[model samples]
Target chain A: MDFQPTEERRMLADMIGKFIQNDYPMKARLTAGTSALGYCPEAYSKMAQLGLIGALFDEEVGGFGGSGFDIATVFTELGKGLVVEPLNDTAMTSGYILAHTDQLELVEQIILGQKRVALGLIENGADYDWSAPETLAHQTGSGWQLSGMKTCMKFAHGADALIVSAQTQSAPGISLFLIEAAAAGLSEHSFQTVDGGNACEITLHNTPAQLLGAEGAAYPLIDAAAARATLAVCAEALGVMERIKDMTIDYMRTRKQFGSVLGKFQALQHRVAQMLLEIEQAQSAVINAANDLQSPTDERNRAISAAKYSIGRIGCAVAEEAIQLHGGIGMTWEYDLGHFAKRLVMIDHEWGDQDFHLIRFSES
Target chain B: MDLNFTEADQAFRQEVIEFLNAELPADISRRVHADLHVSKEDTEFWHAVLHKRGWLTFNWPKSFGGVGWSPVQQFIFEEECAAAGAPRILPFGLKMLAPVLMAFGSKEQQEHWLPRMCDGTDWWCQGYSEPGSGSDLASLKTTAVKQGDHYVINGQKTWTTLGQHANMIFCLVRTNSECKPQAGISFILVDLATPGIEMRPIRTLDGGQEVNEVFFTDVRVPASNLVGEENKGWTYAKYLLAHERNGIANVGISGQKLARLKRLSLSQKRRGKPLADDPLFAARLARLEIELRNLETTNLRVLDEFSKGAGPGPESSMLKIIGSELEQNFDDLTRRALGRQAQAHMPEVFEPGYNGPQVAPQDMANQSAAYFNKRKVSIYGGSNEIQKNIITKMILGL
Candidate 1:
């Protein structure tokens, strides 16, 4: 079995990687993260023009690629630059959900950067329990009236619309609704997350929305979208962990403390070697998960959960050890390690923390 | 065999509490307790307060203007100050150099520098760790050549903690390269105002200018600045390092940080309950508490040895390794408790009256930075690796 990505995927990865490296410096990323719009619209448009967003979807949905490997490749570059954009929420999860419905045109707009959408599957206090949504939708004469709160809605502040998961009175299970940003009785409380990205706590007071997919049949779509998102973040974490490992090695080679470079210390050498082994193991997990994306329900879920769990544990270990090995220099805001470490550690909090995934792995 | 403090020791502890309550500046203590930044001015102000109360030199001999408190009394005072959030007494002047001078300095050196150190007239910084030096401090390349009545010094020193505020530095400079590396060293004190002496800040990972790099380009100092016989600096440096390692354990500060960590865990939620209520989190916290409890006992045993007229031996290295690791662990758990909220990097929020947007809660202001900065504890003061080597040599006789 081949482990390397296809030539087309490699070219796509190179293009996106170069774009991020050339345009998105740490200062620019920080500014974009802190901006009112949450992320750089120009950068998003540039990436869209480069066909980066379209690579996450099938050509039938006005895209060139739609596979777990495609999602992983694009996001790994995003993770390298610490890009604070809404690509995952928009082009990956929301796009997947929309593609499964009759709104194929909306998916096309998403891929072209003409529309930005964020998914609202996580409810307040319902940590990753997307199967039984607490947010309820009441049937109105014309559209639908959505009334509930959604938490951890990343980039929801800047989205053109939100795809929310809710239990409807007309359905026995979870359904999907598309709520416009300017919908009546909708409110968003925005804040900056720890990783220099934006998130919102959304409240809907009988907000006007329209049904997207079939009633009581959106759980499988939501589940699949979440799996793709999980795979993307796992790959992104690999990118971040690799950068941290490289930075640590460079530091050890250059930073002398005892008449010789720190790398000469056998104890520290072992720790760095441990970091390498952990990163390799995490890479293997991500690769397995990406390949297993099209597997049956139990297998796919188990593989994704295993990767997420490994990344959650291994990413933090690598990040923490890198900082420890770099000593005082690793923790500064002016330096790049602190930011990468934060991202690596915080990735676990999203897509379910390590403990959550451990249970998911055991049960699935 | 006794674990409880004597009534007299308890009385001394109460006296320390009363003094902290009366003399400690409320604003300084408030900032320290909240883990906010303590400015240089604030630190000097606290030193002045302690000096006025005749407590600044409490660890020194009574002949050197110290109170000559018991070892247990000293421990009580340190713990109380840490609990009250008092600024740490800068060790470069008061702790590291003073012990060396008291042991090896002539009467003139002691009379001049000791009083200045106590009155805050001369801020001191250690220049023992050069860029190429650190754990191998004896291999330092900074040199001082004898020139008539003056010695010309030329070399660079890095990791000079708080050298920006220091008017004086105690450095170990190479005197005679013809001999062994450890034997050719000499400990000499230099004034920051000396011509050709320069100090540049080395900003730490926490975005702090707490340490610096000092350069000496043919800086001239009086030959009398030398503390002991020429080429005998290595012995004095080793003595100073032993003294430094004893305090590096920082049992009191770690205890204070542990308290803060528990307080934070109580407020942070996980699985819709307080993180402290989570069984896994609670178990880790319990393990840490046990470790700290054992460390305190070990620290006291060492102090007890000191009381019985034995200097800190290689066992002190054990304390250093465990103490530093314990502190790093506490920092790790504290950051994890905040979850993603700890990732916010607002350095300005650490400044004492920063009215800007408080991104995270006041308690969570610098958890990530603290986690990053605490890494130095293991790397500096004879890195934990070096301490292990010392233990292997002296304790295990390996």
Candidate 2:
């Protein structure tokens, strides 16, 4: 019956917020995202030390704090920092799938910061049908052989292995296979994402791969895993959005125009208020989706999609209003405003964009 | 934040649904659910039913003869009522003025007015808007000059909704001509039966007499009728308007409309298929439903906070803007879904028991009326534009 965050969660929130405030500034984040390595190795190590990686899973999965609130709290703080790392894909998307499999060794390595994983699921022009994998896998004497082009392998250049999904000859649906990053038949073309994060185009030719879970049953797991990833993505976007609102409002208070602060204009003030209204609602949707993760499949699915859609929709609003409120300077690359705005747009495209989720939500 | 209702709250919700299902009249329910032009009798009948059940004054304090439900209970009551097609109890007397009287009226005023309002003796309409001072309400020039033991009033109030059926009117009058536009206003209550007062019905865009223009020519009222101090009317008027906007988030009503829209899109055909099967139309409907869901949650969050004893703020204006726009958007979609048939209906098409040629389906005959009448949703109750200004002042401190 309580609408307020618990004392424990509030403490966690304040600690994480301070960690980001004290350690990760916008400039450092920008440098890390646009770096040659595509991330700050030192900062990634710090996050592992802070138990940020371990916070995404439960005790049975070799970690603690796996409640929906934990995920929401962590991602929200990270969003405020605008930290560009591969934790979303590696530790969340691939991490969930790995936890469900009998890969105790790999899961422990991930929490201990000894190994990094990347999800190689999406292919060129694949629009969110997780089971519609075009990559093909065939049975071999030692292990299965995978051959396909996987687009947008998040943090692929940095990860030690890839959780690649491909269609198996014997399976009716797509199956997940774990392939080493340096497997003989693998090649990668790495680049930074639009929001200044790392991803790669991975091409595999008869790549040696090990099945993570039971063959032919990966689609449901993939669907559920994708739901979890989308939820994390939304929570992260909520963090980014609150920061944008804060910065925009602070700018309004100090930035003067025509003998008064820009916030003095009723028109601009109203627009900001409207932005707050939307983001508040978006936040509620995220919380609801987070809570509904363990509910029945149908209810959970609808809520996950609703959360994704609301965050995406509200992300654009926060972006537009923040930029407009900041006026011309908001769009500049050197300023953090433009970065937050761009990340909001990118968040919409991940998992399922607003349009995609809307159709899914309506049809379901 | 927990969205789970306690078991007791769940029980309360079920009780509300049961009450509404058993008591609401079927014919009036049909009109409300379809957004048809509801007669004054329909509203009165529903009002009396709620009153007899000791629920009509749920928003009032218990000591004042109200049900005195918590904000969550109030929300549940409203949600059930709107969902079950119950006519909205007019707020001019119960919701708006009653709160003002409770807060500022003298003991005699409370004893005299509160019981009558409970028993449905007085039907009230607001006298805030004029021809030139709709949004800029402080510029209102409805003069009420002080005289011997009374106040002499002379001015015109425009867009007085339901004034034709009202027995009393609450007005914001210009009491001091030589002071600030805002500071000089006074609030007065005048009996509609007084001489030199004229109420002319104004047929709105929907071709219904939903609003009126009330003119007062030297109408005198006892000084005791003033709610608070003279020249403090603007403050009271603002308070009442805030109350008006408070419940403007009509999420339950919009939920019903969205359901009806879904039903229509499923049964109605376009391009040789069900309208719901059309990709673009389906997308629009889905977006509307998502917005409605989000609005509902946000509303609950606000009501939850209010139940914790938080005062009403101008954030209500934000809710008003969202809720009104959704209703308007739904109306537009309903009409469009009816296709060419929606445009052919007039006022007579919705008259109860009119068995004319089927224009739009019998259930959806009010699409055109709903669309045209709902255009005023954003314009009245101090307009969405005024709401923005209030939000800016209250939140942004601009």
Candidate 2 pairs with clashing backbones: none
- Give candidate 1 misplaced runs (Cα > 4 Å): A20-43, A80-86, A98-106, A118-223, A247-266, A296-298, A326-339, B23-27, B245-247, B347-362
Chain A TM-score relative to the true structure, per candidate? 0.98, 0.97
Instruction: Tell me how far the alpha carbon of residue A161 in candidate 1 is from the true structure, in angstroms, after superposition.
Output: 4.6
On residues A1-364, what C-alpha lDDT tens digit does candidate 2 reach at each position? Answer: 7778788778777877777788888888888877755788787777777788788888898887777778888888889888886677887678789989888788878876778889977763224445577899999998899999776566778788999899898968779999988998998866555566766778899999999898878988888888888888899999999989999989889875444776887877898899999999999999999898878778888999999989978896687567655643453455677777767756775776675687789989
User: B-chain TM-score, every candidate?
Assistant: 0.96, 0.97
Q: Per-residue CA lDDT of candidate 1, range B223-318, in tens?
A: 999998999999997787777534556788779888987887777666566778866678879999999999888888888888898875787788
For model 2, how does the per-residue alpha-carbon lDDT over B1-398 read when each residue is reduced to its tens digit?
67887787789999998898889878878878778767888888888999899999888888888777777778778878888999898988899888899888889998998888877799898898886566567888889988999899999998888899899999989999899898999877899999989999775534456678899999999999988888888788778767653457998788888988888887876435677986867988999999999998888887776777777777688889899889877876775566434433334545767765443566665565566456667767766767887888998999
Model 1 error, position A314 (Å): 1.9
True contacts kept of 1: 0.30
Instruction: Tell me how many clashing residue pairs each candidate has.
Output: 4, 0
Candidate 2 chain A, which ten residues in sequence have the lowest lDDT sum? A122-131
What lDDT, from 0 to 1, does candidate 2 have? Answer: 0.79
